[model samples]
Target: MKIWVLRHGQAAAQAATDAERPLTAAGQQEVRLMASLLQGQPLDAILASPYLRAQQTAALVCTELGYERGVATAPWLTPDDDPCEVLRYLAERQERNLLLVSHQPLVSQLLSMLCEGHRGAHVPMPTAALACVDTDFVAAGLGSLVLHRTPADLSA
Candidate 1:
């Protein structure tokens, strides 16, 4: 299985609520640039957090990649959600390639947990950052981190 995790782009500092917070103009551009990296990849599914910023990011990715299936809003992709639950959810899915658009701590924790046995590694996922992991099955430490890129890397 191949899993691609993307942290939503930079958002405005304030909003009525965290979930309602939309991406800034720069955030939209960052997400578009990051999405271009996946242009030729075959993504079976695109899952994203319900947060406004994540949703916007996913949309940008869909546009960039020309992914017509659209994004599925997932509650488990929230910043504070447990990585274990995400693993279980991935285990249940049958997609060979999956893209996950989510927030900070969840993206970092999920990537670290996937690459490290017990979430020991500190995987820093800045806004618009992306990471790819490959594994025969979804589980802690069983996966290998094949790629990690941030917007800075893409823009450069």
Candidate 2:
């Protein structure tokens, strides 16, 4: 299975609530750039946090992919949710490719947990960054990090 973890674009600092935060103008543009990197791929499903920023990010990617089904919102993808449940969920899914749009700390923790067997590797995830993993399945320390790209990296 190939899993892609994408951090939501940079959001406005002020919002009614953290979950309600929307992406800033720069954030929207950066996400579009990142989306371009995955265009033309047969990506199967997109699972994202219910937060507005993440929802917006997923929408942009889906647009770029020409996907019309809308994104599946998963509670486990929330900023503070545990990664184990998500790993279990992915292991049970039949799709070969999955994209997860989420927030920090959880996103950063997921990167280390997926790449390293443990959560020690501090993978720096700037907003709109993406990391691709090649794994037989989703589990603690069971996947291999194949790619990590930021919008600037793609632009340059």
The top-ranked prediction according to lDDT is: 1
Put down candidate 2 lDDT per residue, 53-129, tens digits, no spaces: 99999999998779887899998899888777767777898888889999888888887888786766899899999
lDDT of 1: 0.92
Candidate 1 stretches greater than 4 Å from native: none
Instruction: Residues 81-104, candidate 1: write the lDDT tens digits.
Output: 999899999999999999999997
Most TM-score-accurate candidate: 1
Give all candidate RMSDs, comma-separated: 0.7, 1.0
